[model samples]
Target: MMKALRAALLGMALAIGLPSGSQAQTLRVGMAAQDVGRLDPHFATSTIDRVAVGWMFNGLVRFPPGSIDPAAIEPDLAERWESGADGRTWTFFLRRGVQFHGGFGELTADDVVFSLRKSAAAATSAFSADFRAFESVEAVDPYTVRIVLRENVPSLLGILTNYSGGYIVSKRAVEQKGEGFARAPVGTGPFALQGVTPNQSAELVAHAGYFRGKPQIAGISYRFIPSDASRDLAFQNKELDLNYGRADQTWATRVRALPGVTVDVFEPAELAMLHLNITQAPFNDIRVRQAMAHAVNRAELSRWRGPDVSRPGQSLVPRGYLGFTAENGLPGHDVAKAKALLAEAGYPNGLTIKVIHTQLPEMLNMMQVVQQQLRRAGITLDLQVVEHATFHQQIRQDLSPLVYYSAARFPVADIYLSQFFHGRSIVKTPTAVTNFSHCNQADAQIDAARVSTDPAAQLKLWAEAQRTLVKEVCAVPLVETLLVFARRDTLDYGYKLVGSMGLGPQITEQSRLR
Candidate 1:
């Protein structure tokens, strides 16, 4: 069915004078990031870089929209899979005739094992946490692979959908190409790297022999324009076919009104929050956390940001997650309640706090708004905005008492829960990404959810854990972000907010550009 759909789309594109062959025209895309460092899927973290690497790689399993059953894992290189009755062991059946781009030979189970093990190997990878649950990965035969888990992990398959975690790389290509392979990766996807201009832009050409089928348009290029306004200008000048991150709704409205341009909104499974350091003096008390939560005006902030663009966040788990509910949610604004809590926490006269943040123009605006809101509740906030790089370092070092941060992921409850609250994560470093009120008992509960096999049981446990964290005033939820994509009307595309931004290549056949 997919092949037939691809053929029909290709025929349609050809009829409209768009390129149908490998040397077809390049579809230019613009983004807010400056560069994509490595095209290697295993090492890449940023969404901008991941989208580029995604084109040049294939995973054993592909996630199609709206499907969660492991048995229904869509095929890329693997044709099918089966699990033992105990659910600890999983076997994958590889496709017989697929070959990697750039003249690598057929992919086999050994390559699968090598790729995963390399990701787990500390010397070779930065994504070790992604595969920490797997006890062993082995090749059962030339075309079959088996994975043994330390325990039953029902979310293992769902976790594999992450670009950093699940993408499969060719062992032959890596061994033959060595370190340079990251820049010039070879995969079985529709697009292959044509050229890269460091931090500026990258070009990709469709691989005619792509296993699924070739993309309708011939090639695609990503132009890095870090400034949102600059990206909008590029789109207006016909230099870009699509723009990924547009925060200004006013500019989005203007762009949509222009000729040959259209705007699409994607409701992301992402969270934007104000992370408070619970280990710090002022925030150590639960009353202090509750006071801050009640002091802020979420509804006003959401309105100021834009409608249908930002909804007041209720929990660390966004609204779309399986276990999110009002009962397990954060406390809303109540100035009197906030003042009372503040007094009880020994700050009756109110105390001043410092908010360390990056100096992005939009971010500064947000911080100013939050600062003013806190002042209205008789709480004084000192703003300490700095450069992006410096701010990130401070957060990672836990030197910052409060900071604004955002995370995008597939709508998996575990992704948010495990990454933020899991006890063993380096991201949960003392002053860093710790999601708990202070990373205490909450960490154990989150870990249990990750390794649990039963879905219903996991949901119940996670829900209870979330309720505890919210009641204890761990992290202050701000809003659930809605991603906006703007493009020239001549370009036709369908985007679903899966993870961050851009379309996943598994569904690229649905994309059309004239």
Candidate 2:
């Protein structure tokens, strides 16, 4: 029965020339990896899925055309916004005449309130924590909504701009359909969800009455090709209009040489780190953690890929982050110091530790190189490579003592710090589901910074918290990632590298070849 259904869907997709069924001008996007499961905007935590949801939904506020900075919030559904002097109350004036797709009619303040409240509701979202700071959301009139907060949140606006926090759904639609509404979301965005095939692809069509104006492109067909090689091949064959995420530098160069292909490189606000489980024996001692940090030769790691690939990561926050400086003062490699620390930790003869790596070829290579460097300092590492999903599960369960992982963040330091180091963050699980390094003080400082309002004061607090985490060796910083997008050069689209993920508003604004 399932096979028959899939065949029918594929037949439909082929018959229409694509799932969107619009040949007038359809943009077909290729992704380097498959989405990490759910398509519901509120449940999307990974960059891969966020790109897809970015097209299917509209938030109260959005990042401007070329800017990914959360600080530069722009009007989306809401036309104007203001906050009280205390910064505890925020008021947003919704734009009238905006209507949801599928004949839902007009948008109002109540819909705004419903969307925001629903995202914060415990039963509906995994990211409720992002909005937990809010005290209440109320509709003042048909076109005005007011939000009251328990305290002054300096990053409240930034949080609201997050993909997970901003994707607004129709109140009436959700109420009518309940849980199934996520699969068929109704919004005031340029595109309307048309169909979805679990683990396959999702299709959307241009909404004729989009508030900004109808997109020049008739529709979008988002294909879910998990393999980077497959995506590259598709682009080479002119089967896709755009591709997201990085690819092999060599392959990227070749694609760039192709006629009509455009390759863009941008610095991503994400870092790949080697996180240690502090609850375990070897890493429990600060001396042992410091030894691991000092043993790594960051120069060699930086050179693993070409200059365009990565930058040496110096702090928890990436280099371009606000308040980041070279002199924030974190310890660096010193072979002698590493040896002395190892001896002090009662491992004078060195110790053998297991290093878990995800299935990504690049990450696995990185781990192997790290293993070689650690061996030079008398520390032996046993490499264990697993599928990405399994690796994440093991880490969340605290089943792995050491794991290679990456954390993506916006241009701000507050949300990044809170989600990783805060005691209550999902990343810091407590049971078999716990990934906490068991660094209690680090968690406390992160929590404190969340409520801090002064930018200067907040930076100082965050710097201290990061330094504390580094000094304790909770996570060893490796490299700040770069955004690498490969295309067939024939497509003309604009992309920006402003945030952690290097996607832009081009998906909603660009025209495609007929």
Candidate 3:
């Protein structure tokens, strides 16, 4: 059965960048899911898609390759960039030798301009909102691109990094291939897409023409197995070099005990937050919101959430991020105070709210703990579970009064505040976007910080907005969980795995089998 499955997996892509029947110097990987969303970086929402494209794309700037700190931005496609004295105009000096795959032609200012415009179009990009500050972007010369902003923005570099809206695509490739560009993507990264076989698997080969030079491994085969047990079995059988790991402590410990396995744990993982539809009735009342805020005991919650993998971060903004200044005043376990607030809000009998969430193990475990906590405060929670994709879809349509979500974004406070709390992004409104709470409380301060050229002033404004979000309970920040992964000890990842910006640990050109 295993042999038949292997044959089916590589049936078509066996000749990729290798003579037919060659071993391919292959590195096989097991993912936590069956497939990725859109392979287009601009619209890719799931981590599977993000990691897939990260191998084929190059952003103008990157987060200092291998470093987990979001603020550590460095040049990628551009050799260096300079800002005008007024701080409104920025010019990027492109690296001359970069080339797109499949002879799409040398990357130039034209491609950069095209990519920026593409990302800014609301019709094309999920990240169009990030480009709101752009006044103009033009190819000044063959290797020079200029960007003019309406105002000086502090998070400009953050937005231009791979984690944000910085990926640059081949204009020629996109124009010629049209919709097909996403399936067989073309970029200037260290690897090129060899083949894709839907939910089963995908193959990528090292790009010898890669400006960064040839990768250590000749090829990679990514196998999609939504079943965690199947993935674990494959890893034990040596069919995969790496496997996506469960966040549960028991699973992590079991993996760590394997003789030839290596386990990596990193911090500042996805923030688990509960968003209340503030546009709705009871939540519309600040007293009721406060009651809900005081209902959670983060310490007890962590035990249910796998203590070794979770920590109570006191701000909507996670720790290790800029403007992380509020750890003192966040609401905590106080059932008596919560009950008093509910009484004052004319709900002495307490209230019931329905929450819609993904059916993943972590989400289920966390919500169950939350259910018990809120019940103590006389708040009844009725949970509706759905598939991961449908949960995101339902919440965006405002179908639930409460929503629990886990997400990671560029560590900039302004971007978080703007996208998640700004009036312009309130869900169900005409401008409905990611603002699930339909909140406008932080709009003024968030906008003020966005345009501030002075870093200190910008940080202060961003900090103020976060404190406000916590106090108002628009979305109660819960815990920042740890990310874990297990890989064969024989494979050596050249760079230190301090942390990762994507769903899984990175497999770069430097990664190789010993």
Candidate 4:
């Protein structure tokens, strides 16, 4: 069925006389996922969906290939943009002749308005919290978009980069496809999502009308091979050109030694942390929360993850992100101190906490290590492990008292602090994002930093925010794990691997499978 679907999609490409359709190479790639969660750019929160939607969409601006630095943002759908004197308004000039996939017609300001508006609406986007400052998005003309913010932000360009809530969708395509758009998305990117074969695989075809130029490869065969052993075997058997690698020292080292294989370990690293719900019982007491913090051994967790692909987490805000600070003054690992705190919190005989954990290999492994560590400190985790997708749903529904979440956001302190610690982002709320800790202690500092024009002042506020979050024992910072990927040496990504916001190696028009 997967092969037939691929063939049918390719047949349609050939029938339409797409450039190099008959001879262009199709790069076979395997991912560590059961299946894609959502392809709608507005709701593509999972790594698998991000990897797919990224190829099928473009934003007003984009982080340069192989970089996630804020300074490296370059024009994409919008050729040029300028900010108002007050820094509250931004005007973007859309590129002419740019076309959307699936004959959705030319890219215009109307689509930009619709996409941005949709991204800011809580009902439509998973990342709507990222756009809380947006007052309005208006189509000034056929090729001009004007965005007004309620207050000054750290970087307006940051919000326009090709990331969560940034990818633009065609107005006509979105309205026409409606909910079906997740399976069949339309955008102005180098590749088009041709078809999805359920749990099997997804087929992408090179967009002949791509503004950048026709893609070097014919397309990508994105396969969902969840098992490490199965995916590794398929890659070794030369059935897959590339595959997501286990992001541990052992796996990375072993894979790098394989014949004709190259392993890439790149940033920004995903920060794994234990969010203790302060609003819940047991954890409602600050002593109990501190006990959990002291129970965690960040160094041991980092060592287990392997120093080659991970580092001990220093702060709630991920390292390498702007405004991050290691001077958070968190409680270090001390089993004796942890036990004392638990006893003081009226859990003298230790406490059993129920947690809903994800069964995803990397996440599960990390959580298992934490469970053992907690057990040593007189805490037993009654882990109710579920499939990854179900875990996400249940966690958001506030079913988990202890949420061990690992994620990488747009390398910014504001985004990280606001989404993870803001009051408005508390889970089970009308405007919820990912405040698993249900912490609002640092709201003042976080809010102050967002509107601060002075860079030093913003950094100071962010530093204060981190310290407050830590002092309040909102979460126990664990380890920062880098992204690991193994690929055939014959494949050329056309650029150096460094950092990717898309959570995977991005295939561009220049990438080739030779």
Candidate 5:
């Protein structure tokens, strides 16, 4: 009876657009997700999971709240750090009097060592591929941590910044709760995870003992509203102070016109790519893969997605990323040439291939656009649409012949190339990452770029790798879609929204509703 009454009241609130007094004290956010996959920072890859974990965890160092530049990284849990002359060994001095949430005790080098080691272990972390250079991590003392790399890297600080596989977790909490830590994580950030209500919401309270300062907002309510209409309706009704906005000009213009609403079309564009499985039958031929490439029209797709929110992707590495180059060795679109190539590959009438795709609105719509474009070139796509989570699982298991995936990484060429195109990251392998295309031709260039000391040398090697990948037709780079979000103008995040590696606005201790 009470549940029905609450629903009735919520419906009435939606109709009347009632403003809640309690909501002013707590920032309510609506995300397009059914639920968070994992709260554990090590395994949180989805936008919803990454956003929640970003608030609850801190790294030794961090990029400024709204930035992803490696040069802008500043001290967080670690006050200072020094690298050895060879750049192989580094030491970090921990901040004193830092407390972990949920009574996990004070932050120390022990927790840092544990968290980093866990991050490097392939058995424990999803991002273990990025830590291939780590030789060892140790606690020099309770307040000092030392890391030894096997070789010099382009930017050691880039890997240590607060992001995927770099977030520090409470050692004691993880050991005490074991696998239960995913449900209730402990960190030394400004916010603490309170609890999670399945398929509904996750609540986080401000950490009183945060090293920086106490958070201005009392708490955060992360509500899961999967439908675009429902999320927008909730925001219109004032139930949501901020919500994930659609990445389209129509949606942005519409939302910006709403009273007190501000739309943010931020940086770190996620590159949408079409990875053709070379191990599969039809795509095994280089001619077929080339045909697939020629069939994709980046401009048409970008126009369909919206020019303000997206741009034509031209390189393997995303634009604005370090070492990105537009000299990718790929030909321009030629439908006639594509059909000729198909005929030469013994598919005179073209071929049909089954593709497992996600039902997520943004991705689904992008695939549909690609589908129509491919149809013009006489290529038929048998799209098998499934739930978002199921799509991820199936694709990882190598069930999809053509995989349309989108991602925004640490804004480095090495991270993108090593994860998406390197042989070690090939699916169904011992060191499996996201190398869905099984492209190993550019492995040497990618590896060389990682250890190259000179900036010019590193960029050259990265450029060479991208050229090789494009020539191989391993994956067709599509539109680079920027992130979009909407918030009430009165809510202050205390930092300018530029580029967030976490893919959301980083709410900090100073964020508040005025």
Candidate 6:
């Protein structure tokens, strides 16, 4: 029956002369993204980049397949690991017989050391800070690795399990490919990179010698389709086996009603936030930042996409994060109080601040709502729109007084606080790439938590950091969006997908078309 349904859909698609699906065993995935920013595992910044890298790489530790649980930690390349009683030293036992792509011999302790050390390099890697606690990484033996930290390093496994810097790459391949490796990455995973056609698509073929097992599907073709409507059309015509769905509930509900279509909505998610640059004039005044924080109506913002599509954000940490709380530290909407604060800040005549955001539709809608709401509080939001990459570039250069960022990261509190609040991360400075707000209030608390051996104490420290940001009004949290995806009912993900950190769903050796 599933095969018949797929055949019918294919017939309709070809009738219209659209491109057809791939071979029966080759699953096609359509992403609503412009391009895969970078394929290098160490520098994959965007969701699409992570998606491609995940297919062909393995991390020392990983979140269990299809499990979105923030605390889910499992062995990936490292079969098992142990840490010293003091929690400063960790040793991992690498799984033997794992072969790198292109038959680059077997994975060993040297590849693990080279991959991790490179990821921690401040001069080159995009995620250098995550590995800041690492004092050293050494190959103890051919299949053994040891990591020693300068401090206790709370939740050390969590750091190694994160998607960004955790992927272990092939040392031999990197030495051979050099700069060209970005286009042709080699890893020891269930699949191997066949090739990529620039901004269009990436083709991956299954590895017969994959350590876990051979992939059920023969191959996968990832298509980069940026337009929502185009993705919908392609999915309907069976040109794509799956699609990254829209954020608004209307689209999700409509898609679910279609025969042989199933829609998945789950969390934890990326927090959509507005970052105010405190270094700037008006924002430098606490009263002005407080006024801006109070001016936001989270309920009103989530209404644009329906409550089902987005959760009204409460804190710096989202629901799935370890330190999440109901009272997230920001004041509720109070226009009268906001106006009073504006007056107190000597902006009674009203202040106009420029905010730059990406071209995504849901973002524009939310910003429009923000524009009207801030007007009621005597704050004019001068909105500027730019493409996604350009928006990230502009915000980092300190160009926009108010910057909008929506990201779903590892469920770690210190990671969030450090990236956005740590002074060392102030973009355009010597070291960091984020931290649009030049915030330094939580440095002490964040540092204290980093070395704490007690879990409860560490959590308390993280929560304290959130409280400081709330009081300082560094950034205003608005909404949390769940990852929503639609697929042909005939396709089987093989694993139970509760949530994911990769671009869409986890397509592993088990996923296949029914």
- Give candidates' CA RMSD values in order: 5.9, 4.3, 3.0, 1.5, 4.3, 5.0
Name the lDDT of candidate 2. Answer: 0.69
Worst 10 residues of 5 by lDDT: 15-24
Candidate 4, residue 35: lDDT? 82
Q: What is the per-residue lDDT of model 1 for residues 1-514, given as tens digits with 9 covering 90 to 100?
A: 4244345444544553456554344577886666666677766644566768766777777655323334555766778888899788888898987777767877888888988898776446646655677899999899999999888764566545535657777889889889988788877776777667766778776666677666666667777776877887788888787777555567567777989776766645347677676778788887888888998888887888777567777887888776565677678889999999988989889989877777655566767887888887778888787755466556656666776776665456666766565555434453233343345557667777777777887888788878877776667877666666777765654444333322322225445576
- Where is model 5 more than 4 Å wrong at Cα? 1-24
Candidate 2 lDDT by residue in tens digits, 303-406: 66556667788886677776454554567888789889999999889999876667655566667878888888888888777766566556766667777766
Ranking by TM-score: 4, 5, 6, 3, 2, 1
Residue lDDT tens for model 5, 313-375: 988889888889998877678899899999999999988989999877778888999999998
TM-score versus the correct structure, for each prediction:
0.83, 0.85, 0.90, 0.97, 0.94, 0.91
True-vs-predicted CA distance for residue 8, candidate 4, Å: 3.9
lDDT of 4 by residue, 282-316 (tens): 89999999999999999999889898999999999
> Candidate 5, overall lDDT?
0.87
Instruction: Indicate which candidate wins on TM-score.
Output: 4
Q: lDDT of model 2 at residue 118?
A: 80
Model 2 residue pairs with clashes: 260-489, 260-490, 261-488, 261-489, 262-489, 397-432, 429-434
**After superposing candidate 3, which stretches have Cα over 4 Å from the reference?**
1-23, 70-72, 176-184, 343-350, 428-432
Clashing pairs in 5: none
The digit string of per-residue lDDT tens for model 6 on 186-303 reads 9887777777776677877777678887676666778888788888999999888888887787898899988899998866677988888899888889899899889999988777
Error of 5 at 398 (Å): 1.0
Q: Is candidate 1 or candidate 4 better by TM-score?
A: 4
Which pairs clash inside model 3?
A: none
TM-score of 5: 0.94
Q: Give the better candidate number (4 or 6) by lDDT.
A: 4
